[model samples]
Target: MAQLRYIYSMPVERIVRYFNDNGFHVNKATANGLLSKTADMFENLYTALGRAVLEDNYISCDETYYKVMDRTGNPDALNINKEYIWAMFAMNLNLAYYFYENGSSRGDVIHKKLEKYKGTVQSNGYAPYKSLRGEILRVSCFQHCKRKFLDLQGNPDADKIIELINRLYQQEHKHCIGADEWTQEDNLKWRRKYSKDIMKALKVALKRIISSPEYPPKSQMYTAANYMLGEWKGLENIFSSGIYKLDTNTIERLNRYISLSRRNSLFFVSHRGAERGAIFYSLACSCRLGGINSFEYLSDVINKAASLPPDTSLEKYRNLLPDKWSKK
Candidate 1:
């Protein structure tokens, strides 16, 4: 299992060639079987880990495009949509899982999948999770919130926007740093003061954008301006809540793996394949982050899933979690 995990984490050609060359020297049929099974095994391994996730954790999610070959055609290639990610939160601090699918994810898709999530979720200005209402507290990623003003940094008119956003960040970072000895309650209170600062900036930015010649409804900056306008409320959610740190760096860090894997492998065969890939990537990536040997984790899980009794199958899996493994 460890070997497979290691290979999946490797370049696709490397994985294919390793099996193909090594397989030919041994037995053709068996080697071909190994080669064919590589992607699928990886798919299952990821599903196992993703299913093992818990519900109470805060999650950060985002989607990116994956381009793949169209299986239905001959001599013609088309870009098929796959997943960039389906990440979950393990703790308040770390990214637990990242699932990569090969299609475009809409707001409804995100909403349906996350319906059971009970904790707060942090994301950029994606619309899917926007309308969902429940125990889930929604927070906007601060980095994205600041991006508009950051873009406006040289425009002079947007200088106030930049100043306010930066000030909020500086305030939070400073307070958190100086607050090493403070209680959680005090920390929450310490940060609450900046809630209005974000609103102030937003209002000012909006008025300027609306009155300017670049209102976006008819300008080249339309998409950027429109996205910011649509996401203003979500972005402001950060200050209203104390638990959320102002950035989606947690999930964006998860995006780095997506960037890595996709940069090399190209795309998936189908959306279904993409979905499974997402699950696998999530588990495998999480394993790497926790310093767990991903192959060992996958191999053990696959073997155990086949033979273990239902009652003990899951417990056995949990026992092997990286955090748990560390204690043993």
Candidate 2:
């Protein structure tokens, strides 16, 4: 019932209706209680997944907004009605973790979450991401840079920049043929050999447009060029390793499930409900990524979790993760 509600985006009332139609009478409160209890069972495993993500070397980060009914009387709570849900995806491990901290999207929330992280973090170069601490190597999204110019369709300068960007992607596609068979060294060599020059040419073109007096500072062309130039370092970080993608497309694609759920169910009734939804969303999406049936996985784990001690070892919880559970 919980899986149907969260993973399948079925509202509780609709779920109850389906049950009643099948000759099983269930109330909305009972359905909500089941969801709460299932979330309690999955909470420990969710924490374990988060720890694993923080320990990973490569992570993609993104955030989306949600509406929450705030009953908290605190006047200074930032954007009480509008909350943000952040996602961290570990590419190497095929793991994902979602976080909702008091319905806050402030820099402090993310800064504290990633305080101990020390590896490459890929994002769209949002301002809050720039403020993250630790040994984090920030990588910007090329698609974001491309979109800036894409929005200025008729401008010749923007079109030229877009053409150069397309060439880089073409080279990337050519090298990615049978990429599953590629070694780290092979990926490194291909990027250095084929992509290096194209990136150099693109950089030069961006600088030329930035320095041109014809395009005013406030013009769309100038803004696009400046934005790309400002994010140049992060964009160039792609060549550092073949493991890095040109954008946060993978995580962004995963975020669609959150969007789907939001569109169907709308706002969470409280902060606690939002947090529980995060746990379900994290585990459900990770199950999808690992090609596991989420319903079966959740059913098994929820039972296993019930039989375990409250002080169960971290290893026990980790074994319940989607990838780990699928292997058994």
Best by lDDT: 2
Predicted candidate 2: what Cα RMSD to the true structure? Answer: 2.6
Worst 10-residue lDDT window, candidate 2: 71-80
Query: lDDT of all the models against the reference?
Result: 0.59, 0.86
TM-score, per-candidate, Cα-based: 0.76, 0.93
Residues 1-328, model 1: lDDT tens digits: 2244223445545555665666634343453355346545444434445455544466666666666555565546565544445566554433366544334466666676677777777777766767867777777765775575566567654566667667777777665533566655665786777557666766766666766765547653444456666776767666665566777776676666666667676765566556555655665667666777776766665554455554554455555555454422
Which ten residues in a row are the worst by lDDT in model 1?
1-10
- Give model 2's TM-score versus the native structure: 0.93
The collision pairs in model 2 are none
- List, residue by residue over 226-318, the lDDT tens digit for candidate 2: 888888888888889977888899999889888887888878888999999999989988988898888888878888889999999888898
Give the C-alpha lDDT of model 2: 0.86
